[model samples]
Target: MSTQSVPVLAANDAASYLDLGITLALNNWPALTLAVQSNWGGPTSDDKRAWLCGAISEMLTERPETDAEDLEDVLIQVMNDEFDVVIDDESAAIVAVEIMEMKQHTDRGNFTEIQAMWEAYQLKSQQKSASAAMFKKVDAKDEDQETDDESDEEGEDVEMGDAPALVRAPREKAEPEIDDDGFTMVKKKR
Candidate 1:
């Protein structure tokens, strides 16, 4: 797993980030906003701040499980540079700041591209399995018909053309030959 840090938005600076996060969420730009909120707490300003660093971290993370340290690192960087707002404001402000950073990192490509790739893989896998199963059933049915035909033949040498279903010829066994020099030649049996 890649090491990711949870951003520590100077506890005083978290409020602003939280607001940005909330705005995006309220404005219907919820993909990134909601995702960030998953890491954020649900109720109250204080609880929301605790989840503040996580919301930004999730935006930067490539997968669902991100490194805490990585999240913290990004949070610190965003707060130190792009956002200078104090973190200790009411929880709403902190939520706003998180929303801002989330907006910055959210990419249309990440959502659409990954979704298409996953769907294509699923479709191909399903088609392959369905094809294999169809072939198997056809093979089994053919085998059953051959067995029935063989039983009806009564040990007779059934003509190949007369057989309704195709039956592969059994391999002929080779016999060993005795050489004039008194050496025995081993023949491969099929």
Candidate 2:
């Protein structure tokens, strides 16, 4: 009899893999990415995204029977509650389906999709860093030009016209009066 080996993943290991897949799936989702990038969830948007990943992982782990529709509903609800965004582009459904597929693959100890997503993520990050560096160089040049222009303007004399002399209204000082108890009291002008 021919023997065949079947891959067996531990419970914790499977959960960890599923969590990673969920993170990568959320990262690639345009709606969620836009929300996080635009700070729609406020200054803690990044934290919110992390929290969402954990929440989704927990939901999937706790409810193994969760389907794409349920996942989609959760995604839409979260975007509305956390980011104040209503998704109407059906992107949430697509992401949900992808995540479900990821779950299936990870359950079988097949991480091809996860590995591919990680590589793509790395490439995207590198591109973003390069673009940011280019922008910084451009901004530095602009700042240097502004400083040079300011220094040149400093040597130029600005003409001022003579103005009329100002007259001040004289104020009458209130004299303090002594009360029956010998306490000094001053009355303010109405």
Residue 122 lDDT, candidate 1, scale 0-100: 55
Per-model RMSD to reference: 19.0, 10.3
Top candidate when judged by lDDT against the true structure: 2
* Clash count list over all predictions: 41, 0
Model 1 / residue 103 / CA error / Å? 17
Error of 2 at 72 (Å): 0.3
Q: What is residue 142's positional error in candidate 1, in angstroms?
A: 1.0
Candidate that scores best on TM-score: 2
What would you estimate as the lDDT of candidate 2? 0.84
TM-scores of all candidate predictions against the true structure: 0.28, 0.71
Please give, for residues 1-190, the per-residue lDDT of candidate 2 as tens digits.
Answer: 0001112335457666677778888888899889998999999987898888888988998999999999999999999999999999999999999999999998898877776776787788889899999999999999999999999999798787778789889887767899999999877669
lDDT of each: 0.45, 0.84
* lDDT value, residue 78 of candidate 1: 42
